[model samples]
Target: MSSAADSNSDGRRNRGMLKSYYTQGENSGDKQFDLDDSSFKPDQYLDFLLKKSSLNELMHQEEEIVQNIRSLDSEMQTLVYENYNKFITATETIRKMKSDFGQMEEEMKALSENMDNICDLSSSVSDTLQQKRSGIRKLAGVHTLLQKLQFLFELPARLKKCIEMEAYNQAVRYYTRARAVLNQYQHMPTFAGISQDCGSIIYELGNALKEKLRDSEASSKQLAEYVDLLLQLEEPADSLCDEYLISARSRVDEKVQELEDVLEDNSVDILEFVDIGCNGVLSNVSLLVVAYNDMFLNRAKANTELDSIALQKVSALVKEILHKFFELIQKRVQLEKQTGDNAILVRALDRFHRRLQAMNKLLPTAELATLATEIVYNAAKDRIDHYYQALTDHLGHCITDIRQALAAPKLISSNLDENSSTPLQNLVQTSVSSLVEQIKAVLANLQAFIATDITFAMKSTFRRPFCFDGVREGLVVRFLRRMLEYLNELCEKPSGPATLLLLLSKLATILEESTIGYLLVLVDEQFLIVQEGDVQFTNPQTLKDEAKAAAKKLLNNYVRLEGQTLSHMVRKSVETRDWLNTIEPRNVRAVMKRVVEDTSSIDSQVGQLYDDMEEQKKDRGSDSTKRSASGLMKSSKTWSFTPSTTAAVLDNSAFMTNISKLFSDKIDIFSEVDASRASIMTGIIKIVLKTLLECVRLRTFSKYGLQQVQVDTHYLQMYLWRFVQDENLVHRLLDEIVSSSLHRCIEPSLMENSVIELICERG
Candidate 1:
């Protein structure tokens, strides 16, 4: 049993062992497979571990990145905030500046308003001055009327007194009263009445005296008859009565002797008294006659021991008085001729009128018209009737003498003709010549009178509205126009030596009155209209026509005068430039600016005249053919081509050279007048620059042979290369040309660079 049991145990052990071996093998296989799988699982585990670690790291990194991003965002936000703050500060500054500018604009507006107010104030002051002037004018008109009344009522009685007695005292009292009235009128607001009253009273008194003298003569004659009758009727007288009569006669004789002695001591010569009396009536006439007589006597006694200066003074006084006298007499004569009543007076007046008409024909219409107006104004009423009557009586006596001479058998028409030239012609010539001479002589006196009257009027209580320039210019223009007309008439006469000399004298008188020193300057400058050796007019119609034409021609001559004056002024100012420097810069600037503007205006007017001439030529259809014909015939034909030829020939260098030469000669480059220089240089420079620029552009573009393409480096380089080769020479030429041209063109004050740039852009 033990042995069997051992065998079984052995077998069981083997089986167990085998079983354990199989289990182990299964386990090993499982393990191997598991290992293989575990290997992948380890990799997976590692990957999982790595993934987990990576996940942890990624989470950490994500957290870190989020923080970093937040930090970066914060920094970016800070930067943006700072930038925004800066922008706001800049914007605030800009806004403040804008507000300040707005305030400045408001201030400027207020300043403008103040300027406007100042202008309004100035205007108000001007208006007030004008109103004051107007008020003064009304006062003068009323003063003239009072003078006329005094002349008519006072002077005749004093003149008619035969002796210095009670009548003379009464007349003197009346005259004194009239003079007091005149003085009172002069002191009043307006002296309107003084002139009229004085004139009328004197005239009326003169007439009244003549009537009084006649009445006195008649009374004396009647008294003489009565005294004779009384003497014849005388009866036998008592002794005592005779003794009384003798005593009375002795007393009367003694009184008469005393009176005679007194009269002899006090009395003047009869002729001297007569002269004094006449002088009182006609003040200017008597004085003038006396002066003339003195002058004549002085000349007759030229070799006497009298002072030459005194003689000259007498002659001057005579001339001055005669001028006044002639003016007064002419006025009176003209007045008388306008109105008359008697047939003889009427006939005399008619003859005088005819003579004036003939004179009017001889003189210029303008002068004649003025004279006629003056005559009409002086003779509007019957005041001149007495003078006309006197003239009629004298003329009637002359007519009677003429009639008797004609009726005489020895008298002949030929003799009459020999004695006098054709009465109408002779009278016209004489009267017209006399009038012209009188006008010349009176000019200085009239000027003095006008100046004195104007000064007095301005200061007087009865002041008239006056403008210094307006009144002076108006009077001067009127006087000059009248003078011009007279000169025209004189110029129409035949060029006789005497007539020529007379004309020169008259012209000299006009020069003295009008231009003074300026006329001599004009003559020196050869600015007068009269040329050397011009023919004088003879026939009346020819004279009239020539005068009219010459009058028109004077416009151009006057322009020359203005030009010369301006030129002289400019030259003088330039010469005295240093002196001008002392003046306020603004004032100098203003004066120079005004001079420039005036010069420009003159140039514009001259240009307008040229344009008008061109228009006239066009209207006449004479320019083209005449210009062409002249060009063809003239030596200057090559250069004096028409516009068409000019355009065609402009391409020719030689032609351009010739043209430039011609232009240079005709245009004064260095003219002191800015306008002249500006016009010429501007035109030439513009043409030359335009032509050169066009030529340059054309040549450059043609060389490229490119169209419709933007300029590129290659093309630019090619052009640049070619341009550079000639650049130095071209640049030098252009610099010289442009500099010289612009120097001539622009004002001296302008910058060269700026001018050049402007020319390049605009030329």
Candidate 2:
């Protein structure tokens, strides 16, 4: 009603605007004519008094009339053009109605004349029959009675034929027509026998119909006819209605099951699959309710008292069948996790609801159409929500599956590519590639659905376009947080070996340099959510930058990781020696050679990883190396960078005393390194070398042990010289290692730099 009123008001307002435009020339209210006023009175426009106005004014009025006539014609044409289709339909309807009415009039007149003639004939016949009325009535009664008796005698045979031919309707009509006559003449044995035979045939027919209804495979149309036949047999309305509803519900159930079990095989087109379920359920169930209505509800509607329990049962089953079908739809939505044309899917659901609504023409009170629509719509809405959640879950699942794969034991080293020399190399290869592959797969999958934003129109205000952007942001945060946390964990307690820690650090770098930027490209292209002056969420560009910082942090962790492993090797070498009875140091000890070689390898791996970050850096450590191949000179220059957290984990008293003795006076040692890979790695070497000095201080050494320490320091200083920015820093750290060993040695003879350099060089 409100909508109707609104439309009427809009029409009136439009009409008034057209009226105002039409009357703009006629400014005077008294002379104004309504646009809809079709009558034109020339007398009103004509000035009868010849001297009332000047000739020029009369000529001007004539021009105005001509202009008004042209304006009216234009307006008429425009209105007709707009309403052309309506005008054509109205003309066609008028013509059709005239033709039909005229034809009906002629037929009515002809029938009237025929009725008059028939009346005359009937009166004449009645006059003639009045004298012989008794004779005619007696003869007619005898003929009718004989006809009924003949039909009764033939009733049994006709019913048998009907059963054989499956013409149950014809048989019922034949039996009903003879029932009263048979009952009236039942005293005669012959009539009684005929009635008995007809009754037996009908009993068999009723059994046959009930059996058909019980058959689960019976088609919908067959079920309808079967119920109809039983109802004609005067089957109890309560039982019959109950049976019909049960059978209909079963048929609906089968279709629902078929949709769940078969249609979702995923080979069919989605729209076709949805349509199959809709048509199958709708057409079959329409037959259910329609046939039920005809047999039972129609009678109840006609004011006949039916069992209320039957009515309620019918209502409950209808609701049940609908709910079951809707549950199937819900399951399908949930199971269809793959993102597709959501518009088509949602529209298909709506089409299904519309088809269900067609059943309202048969059963209006159930409102299953409206109910089903809500269920299917919510399913679609929830499916979208799940799409966003699936992205987050996908990231998490990737991490989890990777962890499980790493946890699985890999004893067969040969299975790793032929290039892999050992199990650790294989671990590095698989771990790094798996993480990269997982992230790449996630981004690729994200690309599929994030751009195709599905619209949700039911809201009163605008909704954000499918907040997959938020999901993308979550992927960034989760990948960073989870990956960094795992990296930190590995650095702290490397699960396999130190190689695993380096691999994780490499993975973190990939995230910072490549993967995070990829994610941001996808996120930034969507809605301009962060207005210039408004508050913002975690902006993707900012996140892209932060990932770089995280990469550096992981590198520092890598430093601590290698430092621990190398420091352990130093301790084991010192612990295994018999310093009291040891022979003279020949060249450098194997442990020192291995440590020097591994340090060079570490430098190359870490430097190459971040080489591009600083293209042509001046090697400050190389300057110190050029000063003397002998070793780093003890300098009073303050230590330029703070040691990593590895240093903080140990007590400073022994380590502090070692540092104080190595320098002439204690130099300030706490300084921060830049978060570049080179700076970070230089800090790692300084800390690890200092750790080596601390390990030396922990042991007691004889003369050869002290010489071995000096040889190791010279070789390390020579090779590690080219790796760090502040060359003096590495010199000071290796010098401190020798100084600390001398302090602990029982016999303090040290190898000269010339001798140590020649032995390291020649070997």
Candidate 3:
């Protein structure tokens, strides 16, 4: 009900405002009435109008509203009539255009059918014409291709005719052209038949040329033709030509065989027979090279521009000759292995070496020259080896005799028995001097063969059984080393026999080298010793005893090695056979002095250790005391306290273990000695006694400590007895042992001091 009333009120307010707008009279304030509060109260508005105006105002406003309504309704009707006429005219025009479009489409449909009929006729006629034109063009292309490739079609037949006519040059031309075509079209099946035919022809050509090369009685011109044909073939022909030359080398075998027969008869001179055999082989090889070169002079000149294939071919032939030559010599030389007959055989070998050296100069190729060099070297080396073998055999029993003499001190005399005609004396002075001259001659020839540089020359050649690996020194150097090694063993055995020493000195004089001196240096360098840092020992007394004994034996061996052996060798020098002329004994004494100095160094080290332990003990102080009573004792003393005080072992100082280590380390220092001779042994004993005394003064010890020292002294004494067993030496050593043990560790009474003094003076 309120909504209906409000609608009626809005309608009344709108109508009144409309009536005021149309009837615009008098009050201009009524034109701007407030409509913001649109909640219209019609009765209130009517009352406001009634209070402001009369009924004439109301009638006049209603008549103006009717006039404005009539004017708006007429204008709206005119606008609708105009738009409706335009709509009728447009509809009529559209209907007329639709009829014309339908007629045009009907005419287009008929025209399209007519054109379709024309197109069908044109398509049929064009297909026939295009087929004819394609056929004509294909025929033309076939005719043109055949004309362009007419040479390819005739190439196989032309090649066959040329080969049949023995026109090899013409055939090669056709084959070369055919190969070019095949290379261009090889992937296509059309060329396969002709390519196979070409391959067959080439194979036939090669076989024919090989047959010509195989002909034994062929002249140089005939051989040259085959060589030229093979070169024209220009596939890798080195191996093929190598085989042909090897066949040519068969002639040398016949010559060598004849020489072998002559060599076997023994009536023929061996050197003359070898010369005949080698010259025949060299002449045949030279002829073979000349024949090969004459046959292909032009081709050879051309190929020489790249590599000397001709030289390679001829060098291969030369190698074949050398092969046969070595085989013959090696067989004959192998049959005669008697050292007594080595000189004649070696002389024959030297002749062969000379002939090979001449041949080496004649050869043009480096390969051939290298081959000749190898042949010469082998010959020279065989001679040298044979000569040395004879020398070694001659000296064998002498070496054994000398070794037996060296085994005992008085078995062999150091001076020559001038009145004696023993085999050893004869072998050393006579046989040995002659052998040294022979060896020198052989080595000189060898040095010449290798051109004074064996390593560089022989490195690119061959190595024989006696060759030293990585040796820069020549064959003589190695041979000298080997010979000296064998002789040094013979002569240096326990003051080597004087004759052997004399032979060594003679060899050194002959070679103008310090032969024995260098051998001594090699011995010294090879002197295997326990590196001082590597000599280890344990705390166990037995193990330390074993270590000390082994070390003593090694030191004695070193002493004997340097003193008796090396000193005797140097003393045997012609200028130094006696004390007045010799410094060897003095050198030995100097070595002994150096050994004493080394022991003195050990004494100083123990003294330093003594002071260090004193310092460490002071630092170990009351803390060490609270832990164990053994802390107050020296390291060597605590071990004597037994298993009952094992906990105190750790608290004991490490001084004694360090001393044991020092003892082991000091033992190695004597390994510098090669031998302990009579004088060397006495010097060593004095050093050991002084060292023991130093140990005594350096530390305060319990009974066990003194016992350890005594045991060590006894072990050293026992080792020394093996080299020196003098009773006075043993007695004096034992006296020091007892006095040091008693006066130093056991009891130091005033009365015993005199006894100690007497023992010390006796020592």
Candidate 4:
């Protein structure tokens, strides 16, 4: 009570001290600090602060003041830390500006001197040329007249020389200038002959220009130059433009056909194919677009422009040619549907994407350039989808293979030692290595894909989720979901005991031991790492927990299947017999030997298989095995899946029902899987014996048949002791079978206990 009173009193003192440091302002609930309180006409603000407050309160106020000072100091330091680089940059900029001002002053003085020198030189030159200007002007006219006469006399010969030199551009310039003068005086004999000769040579130059335009080997610049010359010659571009466009179309076609031929060449691998696309087809088509644009769309400054009608025609053709070229680029770069193992095409798609980026940059104004880039980006997405689809199909095939293997009769010629290898072990390891190899190849390809830098302008527009956080998480999720789907297909029908358990062991071991670690390496080293320093791509431990749970569920499923198979065997043995008519029990029936022999096989397969089923529990931080599972596999080095709740991973209810029918007890089947193999085996053995007892109670046994039942029960009891350490469950089950047999016996006779033990031992 005193502490609470002291705390309240301290709070009041602190508030009084705070208000004392500054004048009292208006209350917040009223008009706030708007009241004129700056005049220091305050009343009892400090009446209790200095005169009545204790030394402890004063000391407390001083500590808070010191703390505020420290806080302010910390804030000042934070400001400096945040803006230190900017402060240093500002200092350097100021220094540089000062130095630049000094240089500017000197440059201004030099500029002023140069201007004065230019004024003086201009004055002297003007004085020097003043007297001779009239005479020089008069001679310029005479000089022009004489030069024209000389050019007319030499025009035909010069035109001939130009034709031999293939200087059509120069020839056209010369002939067009001369034609005006020749026509002015064509009535005179000399002028008319010059005009006639020039016309014929000009005709030949026109023909050369047309031929040059058609030449597919002509460079873009050469084509533009030829088109310009023809335009200046007043050649009607309507038909000529059509021909030119056709020639451009033919060149693009040739490049596309060449690419097609390369595609048809099976000997050329994907990398080579991508190379041809970038260098040969991609470059050629872009060049054709550029050349066509230059010739038809670009207006030359000095040459006569094409008429509006002709330009519209040419523009339409240009659009057609450009659209076709882009279409070709789009169709060619699109990757085909391939299996997941073939995701190396991602690298090839990246190469094409880069080339398309160059194309867009080369012709940034063309709508086609941007469209082509977008198309290629979508193609990349489609390729990734196809790769995943292929992987799904590949996994489906693997599941099918397991189904076929399970359908065959299971045989184990020998017992499996934990340290020794078996076909099942080898097969599981090989499958894991095969999958990891596919993932490694995919990682390699996608690494190259992400390494490709898109242009800043395209980056926002073309950004894909391919590299967000790490692609590993999404990929792993999809992969695990599909695999779970395949596993569920087996669960839909009742498969044999070995089938699901073998698959569960193989898959769970690979997932926890090999796959999860590979994913970590893939994200950390090979793929994009998130900068936030969080393992959001996937948390290793949480995923491990989930995997552990899933493996437990599979174990329960296998456990239930084991019980069903054993019970089935018992039912078959009991149902096939004619218990009412039989000979004296000869050396315990073959059914008991079959039962024990089958049980021994179970011991060997399950003991080894469950050791495998107990997968991933062992910190196999030691990944033991690697093998190649495909002809396409390069080597053993690279290798490269479920769920929560009851979706598919846990088959709790149905399994529980089947188990309840067998055991007649409310056993938590799921809880039992965590115990030793002996407990589980004992539970299943007791279930099978109980089934035998149930079969005995249904029948009326003859005295010999009763003896047969006694022998088989004793035989099962003695031999099965090797499997179950706890004989209590086995004893209860076997004893019940004898009592039921005695009750069902028509003669009501019984074999001696020692007689029964000796008969079972003799077998």
TM-score of every candidate relative to the true structure:
0.18, 0.52, 0.34, 0.54
lDDT of 4: 0.62
lDDT of 3 by residue, 571-645 (tens): 232122221222211111233233334433322222221113334335435343211112112223324434465
Number of the candidate with higher lDDT, 1 or 2: 2
Model 1 has an lDDT value of 0.35
lDDT per residue (tens digit) for residues 625-740 in model 2: 34454424333112221335323322342476456666655423333445455665576667667767777778888778877777777777766656666666776677667667
The best-first sequence of candidates by TM-score reads 4, 2, 3, 1
- The local lDDT score (0 to 100) that residue 231 gets in candidate 1 is 22
Angstrom error at residue 581, model 2:
4.5
Reference-based lDDT, each prediction? 0.35, 0.62, 0.48, 0.62
Clashing pairs in model 4, backbone N/Cα/C closer than 3 A: 435-640, 436-639, 436-640, 437-639, 437-640
lDDT of 1 by residue, 495-515 (tens): 222212222332333343334
Worst 10 residues of 3 by lDDT: 579-588
Off by over 4 Å in 2: 1-219, 225-238, 249-282, 293-500, 520-557, 581-586, 612-675, 703-705, 725-732, 747-763
Error of 3 at 124 (Å): 98
